[model samples]
Target: MLRFNLLLCFLFLLPGKHLFAQNQTGKRYKIDRYNSIYLPLGEISFADKLVQFKVGNPPPIKKYRDSTQCLHEPNYRNYQTPNFISLGCGGTLTVAFTDNGFMNLPGDDLYIFEVGPSREAAKIEISQNGKEWVYAGKIAGGKSSIELSDAGIDNETVFYFLRITDLKELCRSISAGADIDAIGAINSVIKLTINADVLFDVAKYNLKETAKESLDSLAKIIKKVDKATILIEGHTDSDGDEISNLTLSKNRSISVKERLLKIFNNYEGYDFEVKAFGESTPRFPNDSDENKQLNRRVEITVLPPKDYYENLINK
Candidate 1:
């Protein structure tokens, strides 16, 4: 079985929690011993790409109108700070975690760094792909966190994209709407995505011969990690019945895991886990052929070692 608690302490420490560990190199590391999530800011990974942005009817000043400002980590320190982007009333913005993503864990899975004192709120939604979204509730201005489990989403689900729409609750500030500094994943994972069509025939779980190259490349990447739990999740389109789709997804994930294990037979410092979501979690709606193809895929999430963030913080 996979250990979910192992990475919890390393990912995001509770409001006053702290962890200290010493590696073989006699180096001590600290993950997050600070107050709010923004303390670690640029040190750790956060949403990296700005996918889409639309200013509402009442736009913010030109200084705070740059959508790219919301990319990466939050840099807003005070009301006078200009590091964040302001979405006008009823504005919307979407961001992507290119290198890492968040999955449901013990507590809050995501956080929003919405600066200012107005307590502006935003309708927050999450997605595996950028198209289909799951309402994960709202972030009430300032620095707020939301648990993915609260939305009744699958624990095995990992989201790469996040969409935030300004509720226009408090548009009093000069920035208006919601001033977003950054979005961070509390339960973060290093993700690698591969289209299912590349690995199998139509509706089949068996790995095609062509999958060898992809798996080979994946294995090489996995070997580079010092220590981690590897999660192999399989997903499919909604063409088949629920049970059949679920079984197919499970077998597909198992197939991928088995192949990777063969290469890692003599390998150490890693634990492999498999999960299947079938049509339960679609990155995109199955209405179109292209979208269906996009939904049929596999996501490999690499949970960092217990001391992964510790090492990162120390660096």
Candidate 2:
């Protein structure tokens, strides 16, 4: 499930982590939100679409700038009420986005919708300033996606532009080229979390300098949330004396809250509450060092007020 949270709450896990089965404790899996690039902040430029590629009025580039990646889904065509077609043959299209470029990450996808009756082939390309373009490669009509690494281009290449060109020769009717519905700079949600060991020394609550970067990034996100309550939770493994463990958890949660306040105090419209679970809320048994490390952590959860949604809708 793609949660609307736009940023990762912690560093992402390695591949196959998503398939990991949950233990009997009922701990929900975390969603990855690190690399998400919000769309509606992009535009399609220098595009050509066949007359048949569009059902009625001239195709608007705006149609393909949304989050919808409706390919092969019959009910969704052209992205809007009118379906889409290709440029017949030799037609090309390009989309420019705000992100410096897409990253070379595992399971990344560039979604594109293809029209039917017949599948067609198309060439894809990437660019930095839009003036200089690089070959990305061919995309089959029905696959509905492209791999960023397939271009095998420099991972440093900041991708601001995407191009698709129809390859079919001998012009057919209309809709010969590739028809598109939407494209995304990213494909999944991102999560951000900091390991307790990394953020603090053993049995200590104060954050180390190494933890500053992560909290800085988190602070920016909190500011962006604008209006919301925050929940600062402190957790600990089943180690040391039980009373000390509970006190350590409380002090640690307070430490994080104080640091965040120093950074976010300038802003208004927000408040926070603090709580500590001690060893009672073990994500995993503290039978192993690794599990113990996992148990000792602090979490920040953004809580929008009850009327937050209602207020936005009424606005």
lDDT of each: 0.76, 0.54
Residue range 1-315, candidate 1, lDDT tens digits: 146776675544422111112112111222223445422212244789999999976888778888988887666767676788899899999998886777776556777777766768899998999999989878873547887778887877778999999998867667988988877776777778899999999988889999989998987765444356788999999998999999999999999998987766634455688999989999888999999999999998777554445654576
Candidate 1 local Cα displacement, residue 274, angstroms = 5.4
The sequence of per-residue lDDT tens digits that candidate 2 reaches over residues 1-315 is 245333242323312222122212111111112222222112221121211122222222444322223222223322244444344456666655531235333443354545444556777777766778888767674555566677786543345566667666424544445555444443211123457777788889888888777787887755443444567888899989888898889998888888887666534445677988888888798999999999898877554433433443576
Can you tell me which runs of candidate 2 are displaced by over 4 Å? 1-67, 70-192, 306-315
How many Å off is the CA of 65 in candidate 1?
A: 1.2
The per-residue C-alpha lDDT of model 1 at residue 21 equals 26
- Model 1 steric clash pairs: none
Q: Hey, what RMSD does candidate 1 come out at?
A: 10.6
| 10 residues in a row with least lDDT, candidate 2 | 23-32
